[model samples]
Target: MAHPSLTETTARVQEIIGSDAITRIFRDAMSRTLRDAFVHSDGEEVFVLTGDIPAMWLRDSAAQVRPYLPLAADDPGVADLLVSLVRRQVRAILLDPYANAFNARPDGAGHAGDETQMHPGVWERKYEVDSLCFPLQLAHQVWRITGRTDHLDAEFARAADLIITTWQVEQDHAERSPYRFQRHDGPPTDTLTDGGNGSPVGRTGMTWSGFRPSDDACVLNYNVPGNLFAIHVLGNLAELATVVLDDPALASRARDLAAELAAGVREWGIVTHPVHGRIYAYEVDGLGGAVLMDDANMPSLLSLPLTGGDAIDAEIYRNTRAFVLSPDNPTYTRGTHAVGLGSPHTPPDHVWPIALAVQGLTTDDDAEKRRILDLLARTHADTFRMHESFHVDDPATFTREWFSWADSMFCELVLDVCGAGVQSTLDEEQVPTP
Candidate 1:
């Protein structure tokens, strides 16, 4: 059989699923909007949005279109577009290593860049560590899937070094760096303390993250899932150094960092669940304190598999899963329209489609997937687009005018179920990579 373009495959799905079917809903959503959201308009950079946030969050943009890596590989135009996006992100880091978000083009507002502003788009600038981790993951994944390395250039290497330096500084935040954000528009409790600079902590091996992967402020000093992602990021860095750059020294450094991070997680990031007995914590301080519940975000406890953490011990993960999916987890919510998790970012009753898609992707039960699929299809409000979060009880009141990450993840989960080669990198990394 011949490989089909996304349109043809999507046509097949729409054929099987009524045009308004569960999976076809998101397929059509992306069909109408993804190109515009992702393609660089006005020749700026292509930093996708989450719903309608005008600013391009470094983290969100990378994860948003990541599912397209495979599809882009097969289509040169899309592949070129992704490469262009990566280059734009690399430029942002070079301009301001501290800010995690950037305006696709400089508006003379962010930290300073010689690069000219591309019209109709400007990079949003805010510093977040995980933001640096994402472009490497995207570039590496695109290269791995496409067998193309045209975009990996001197700037990427320079960005890698800047990331290393930034990471090192963050590891010792008590003394090294000076960065903070305080959003006065929201409630004082709704925002971070100390101007969002973060609370202080002891010198543990764990790296400091000003923001969680959720792009929100961290309550505790150490974020377990973010650290888990850091471990994965370090692994990818090593792979990129070796596979694409042929820089064994950088690869070794990344490997050492990954080891250090894993050890830190072992030391500070896990706890003994009475039920699971040895489940990981959401965030930790290495000072005998840990947050136990999970959120509905990527790098979430639920997304262990998607983020490259394996369920090596089914019984333990099963127990942990039961705890999270049940009433025990604070963020877990259930309603007539949807039943999943919600973060503080949304109203109490609202649930994120990202979480539902993740619930579908991570669960082993067909019934659970179907239930989630049902909720997802019903909650889209017939725009055929996924929202950042829907009112779990109501399924209507959603946020964001443009959200590309949810759209991408929804697409990836559907593709995975359809045998679209969305291979888990967990197993590939479990053993040594040659």
Candidate 2:
């Protein structure tokens, strides 16, 4: 299936956004990452490699195409691309739910040595919980917005069951789980201590993730945000099971598991900071310890609302927000170009556009949102495309020259600010008929 040329897609986006300068920014940003990262095979498969790397991360592939879902209902080209990507993601998950990233084909292509379990199709086997959650999130979005469920076939149902089972095992990770990972040569964060299993957790009801969304090993196995996200997407899975798959038993299990996880989170996830009152921790154990810092990634404490886990206005969330965005949080950085959060995965003093856009998306303050937009618009470093992270003091000096997830998120922020309702452009009369 041939997609619309870049020109046509840009024109459609521009027509929807309705702001000349902002549309130009969106067009340039979307064109670079979306056009470069995605590819469709001669078969009924599609693949989306992470920017500058020829591998598809389950987490990234889901996020990189999210901004297109609402638009898919209107644009056949966008719709086809997203639908194909959904099919590809379902195949990857069915291949291995424990594997976070995969090669385009069953060829020995990536990270062949850092061993937990190796598959020819898998690029890296590091088990980040968000990697599993993201495919469900994307599938849910595609179904809700486009009303297309053909992609939700038998294999997709099997993958959903696998995810629930994995989470159930990880709930008792120390005893029941078999996943382990070790990287001989890399940064300290890349390798887990205690041989391959990550730091110990005390069965906090939350599922264990061996790695963070940054692909860095977790200091505490039960990542608070990831568990929160699991609850949200598990609910999504429950609905999908009942409505799409028509399996009430599977739906009941998902709902019960989500409720158990949420109960655990409420018990151990919230900490009373002296300055911030009750707030969410980045990572926690069922024991007493908690990491009171946030990274500049989705599923961070700052992104609860964005992930559909919690409302931004919830009291504890507001408290967490203040702590996450303030200088008191060790990862929060203030530079000449921007003031936002950074991650250990990148260099010091670099701010992620993803964090900034998420802030704008979750905030109700118009002025604050505009301020974030101005910072994002000005920091594209003359390329008119978003980068992974820019130097806190110097926007031009950035990392990851081509990152589609960040680019897609920036496009989402643009759509929000420009008052472009998600499906507004796809109204019956406005949609082009072939």
Candidate 3:
């Protein structure tokens, strides 16, 4: 029972995708990519990418199917599929407590330890708080976007508790937390120490993150941006605990942690910015050590608002914004075609689509948004498919063809162009910060 408007919209989408004309290329590009990336096999989650990589990620898989969530309310086909993806992610979280990515089965074709590959039902063991955090955001959003809360169940409560306990223990990395990892690729610097595992950081009031949101090792324990996000998410979790699930104890726990993370950010995350007066650092040691640069990752300074969090008016966000957009930030780069956030994971001067969209998402200027849209249109290398990162100079030489998150973010950008018309019924269900 497709709504008349959606029926019309789908037809238009099909026509635009089928038309081999240049004017409608972007629309077609998005359509073909969506078909390739969002289609699930054997009643499973959509593969976040194509090629040799074939599996779902807690983060990427949620992102892949998210765009179609609003359509599911009227389209039964999409609704059933969305529910399946949630079940897959819930099963993945339950599969192994510490894993960030998962597969559909144990004998999955992908390598066991590769952080990037997906083995169906087999979660690659990476202890990133972001991994757990994304599912909650996506699950809540899916319900909101489609008026479907069928996915929120007993398992969600347990997963939420696991996240809380993990964070609480990790706040004191010395003896309280029990997490470790060792990557064998990249460079020696990219690899962690103390037997490829990170050395313990001195206990700070803030929770210890073994890795930054980038999945790279944290030089300073309190990743300020992540702490900011923790405040935002933990605040949301506090409400979800009380209002959504009606558990006073869990709500209280979320509140305590939310308040603590905010306090920690204020007391420890801020640093003196000689030019901008004061700014937040990328990471802080709590004992005075701070890494004063930004990465091209979400939960990044630029992505604060994009993650559905409150704005940090602190001078440090402004300062860090300036630094991140400038050549001063190690990861920032400028090129002939475009200038934006880059990352260490990719080649030098490679711009990330996630970073670009975040900037567009957080920017208040319509002109800036349009500019980003055009760059993205041009930067997709005419494939209309978003890549993880592209050479700042050449758009074709990119990485990660099947990144559904980037594609969804690009769709979000297109929606933004038309007044960001994509609304989730879930947004109206916001419980409000108490």
Tens digits of lDDT, candidate 1, 182-202: 555544433456656667666
lDDT of 3: 0.66
TM-score to true structure, per model? 0.87, 0.93, 0.85
- The 10 consecutive residues of candidate 1 with the worst lDDT sum are 113-122
Q: List runs of model 1 lying over 4 Å from the truth.
A: 1-4, 15-19, 39-45, 108-126, 189-191, 310-317, 424-434
TM-score of 1: 0.87
As for lDDT, the candidate ahead, 1 or 2, is: 2
Residue pairs clashing in model 2 are none
Ranking by lDDT: 2, 1, 3
Off by over 4 Å in 2: 1-21, 310-313, 421-434
- Give one digit per residue, the lDDT tens place, for model 2 in 217-325: 8988888889888889888888788788888888998899998988888888889999999998899978798989998888788888867454223899999999998
